[model samples]
Target: MSTRNPGSLIARIGASLIVLGSASAFADEVVKIGHAAPLTGANAEWGKDTENGARLAVEEINAKGLVIGGQKVTLELDAQDDASDPRQGTQIAQKLVDDKVVAVVGHMNSGTTIPASKIYSDAGIVEISPSATNPIYTQQGFKTAYRVVATDAQQGPALADYAKKTLGAKSVAIVDDATAYGQGLANEFEKQAKVLGLTVLSHDATNDKAVDFRSILTKVKGEHPDIIMYGGMDATGGPFAKQARQLAIGARVLGGDGLCADSLAKLAGEAADNVVCSIAGMPLEKMPDGPAFEQRYEARFHQHVQLNAPFAYDAVYIIVDAMKRARSVKAADILASMPGADFVGVLGRTQFDAHGDLKQGAISLYDYKGGKQTLLTVVKM
Candidate 1:
């Protein structure tokens, strides 16, 4: 004992203390939330906006601090860029699963959401899409799939009804990017448009990545349709509208939520004036919590909120609400609690039906005037 080296004993004590600290820190649980969107492509603005909404929720939750299963929990967002590609969406979903994310907040487009949804379902991870509206996304019987927005089923009919009854369009020409979201919306719109007695002059197909729509516009122009409906995202929809205006086509351009963004005005320029679109949720100014949320969002993001940001924000709270209800941060527990979620969020009461679709959903129609998005009407569905 007298010959014991003091330096060695001090080093051993220091190592022991480090191990204890590490273990103490590890006691705090980290709940990883996954977000997949096109953060690097033409849809980057929307993707980043969605990510920011989730981030805001995560920050707020962490600030308040969550206690799950008697342990301090920290929420972490694992944001991934799917680039609006279905192939990349699945890859991102798998990566999130491998990383052990407890839940997912996205796969923004229906095309990406549909393919990636299977992966999340297989992994038993609950995924709530803030923006994917294709009816097929939830009809597939994936218990893990959920959405905060109205589907194309409701949105399409609303747009079609408006076009037929309000806009008094006797004939419509449809152009789709041929994506799951685009085609699904176009089909639904055509179905309802037909029922409303509007003639389907021509239904054309264009890829999502296509920029030159002169050919499509030329064909559409030849039809002399009263309204030109495009089933695609703002990235393509905006350019298509601009080209239509450049070609001097007088038909009013119409689209769904994919084209209902604040940035569309800038993207479509003067053409945006004739652009009429529909979104899956009520206008922010109309939502009970919308104005306050907008102010908070602008302060945090240093920019205006986009079409789906509020939905994304509500989705994060929905996940956290599930965690709180289940009293655990485990994925299985969250999934178990998700079905009965009745949390009142910025978008109002968030309750899911058996199909994982919002029980009370609404579609808002919009148009651009003086380079600003103006809500035309709110149609509850």
Candidate 2:
């Protein structure tokens, strides 16, 4: 009992040294991923939801004992608040680059994503948008830019098609927020609506920040159209619907992804019932792993997902998949491996084409009923 076995003592020391060495390696190797969204203002809930998704993914990845290039890698999320402003998005992009983030997962709106894409391009980092639906985001030929959702080119027509065929809208009034997303979606909707023989009464503009749209609503109400399509986010679209009702404009309201939110009803009060919107993805219930993911999300965040959280979650996993395929965490290597990736996550198949657009896109139509978003149908494009 007094004598300690020499072999046992040596083995114990070796094990202790190995544990310390691994801990040191793990502490030294950290990979940063950037997320940018409107974490303040009316859209803050959306931003927070997306950030939580990225946070959950990072936490899980780190727990898996991630290793790249023989080093134990700890993933970190560098979330920045862009406030849905274009200029601020670019600034955040540069800041993330300065911080040496390997890849980025947001900048929610097209107005923000487009300007920030150049910054990420110059920095040689990959940027994937979870919610930006403007076609120009991918059409710009930026290899570094990608989006998980469908673009306005697809989403606009789907919404317009629904208005024409389902709602049988003979004439429609178009109102846009004047932002890149709003303008682009409105343009596509207008173009398709005309093709379908739907009379386009007027196309008006509004600022995203403006709450009082009486001026525009009054002008639009005069037209007496069958529907009023507001190309904007829930923040503006909600009030737009409410004001339209207030002005006694009985036309139904329609819009693209920007207006598809659970909070739209609360924002517009009872007026949300007249709103029909399209999101450039399948319904969460339709997503392959959506149920389990939703359970995990609520358990971790202690709140219902607002929007785009699933896409953001998948975006994080996509970046990690690329890193694993390349067997390196370097941005260049990860990006090099991304072009051919076929990662499957909560969103099903996450693949991109040469233009960095989704290989297959879908549009899910929804309508507000009794203060909740009710899914109508999902159209694949």
Candidate 3:
């Protein structure tokens, strides 16, 4: 048995094909962008939505005969599916490295994105995540790792504050699915909960494969807290919500954007009504170009777009815009151009800081009430 480095796997994935497409036409000039997410398995919806946003950006940019460095060029997407796994993320990252993607927009789950980022940074690939909000995504001093949305440090605490002050939660027990994204957020939320004067009762963990939460929930329920703050992607969050209800745990289930989506309504059924989660990006219907994106999405896929689709959309445009500004599709050109760049995007005007974090943190809180994802509050942190 042998293991392959991510840089080695980069040669065979879509990254290579996409980079090759631009290279063959450019006499060595090419602008290659890479994307990775869970396009299959339990959380496929989120992966596809991100793919749609990136694909739409590519289609629109190519249609215009993208002009960069006085050379007519094509923008290519080197996409792969990490399937929401950190190990698979390394595999996809190797593919992107081989393809030499100038910029990237993916690995939607923060747990995976945070680690895959080291690969991209080592390769000097500029990556701007459309959704991964874990604080460490940019905190590791990776100047090339950017996020269009705010970090969980901002999003998780906002929800925690609301839960304590608005919901009047006195005792709160935190639970996470033990993912980098989930635990990272739970860590922050618990810290913030204490700062906000909420009593910390207990903490629990769950993973993607988890189906039985009886033991943990029983202990959390014993705390008799007013709320259960969960930190995990939606694949498990929805089921946890439904299960918590069945177990007669009456506390409100609070979570970050990972649990905020329309499908949760279907998964959680009656439990969905009162479940609240923090959200990144504006609701799909409310973005500047959202209505049109929604209509085209429904026609093309016969499904509604989810929470972070707009952020993904903006991520692609930023990469393409960098190409146009550099006037060269070369990876080096894109990386040099992405930092400190400002652009108008779906979430509003956005700029990247030196470390690749958003210059001004932008995120919103959404509640899954009455079977729809509704915006409760938009915040800048």
Best by TM-score: 1
Query: Alpha-carbon error at 301 in model 1, in Å?
Result: 2.0
Give the alpha-carbon lDDT of every model.
0.93, 0.91, 0.82
lDDT (Cα) of model 2: 0.91
Please give the clash total of every predicted structure, in order. 0, 0, 9
RMSD of 1: 2.3
Worst 10 residues of 2 by lDDT: 21-30
Candidate 2 per-residue lDDT over residues 1-381, each given as its tens digit: 669899999999999999999777557488999999999987899889989988889998888889876777889999999999998898999999999999999989899999999998887899999999999888887889988999999998998999989988899999999999999999999999999999999998988998999998888878889999899999999999998888988999999888889889988999999999999998888999999999999999899988799999999999999998899989988888889889888889988999999998899999988878999999999
Better of 1 and 2 by lDDT: 1
| TM-scores, each model vs. reference | 0.95, 0.93, 0.89
Candidate 3 global TM-score: 0.89
Name the TM-score of candidate 1.
0.95
Q: For residue 240, what is the lDDT in candidate 1?
A: 96
Summing lDDT over every window of 10 consecutive residues in candidate 3, give the lowest-scoring window. Answer: 280-289
Backbone clash pairs for candidate 2 read none
Q: What lDDT tens digits, residue by residue, belong to model 3 across residues 174-272?
A: 899898889988999998899998998888787877877788888887889999999987778888888889889999999888888888888788888
Clashing pairs in 3: 6-94, 7-94, 9-95, 10-94, 10-95, 30-329, 68-327, 69-327, 177-206
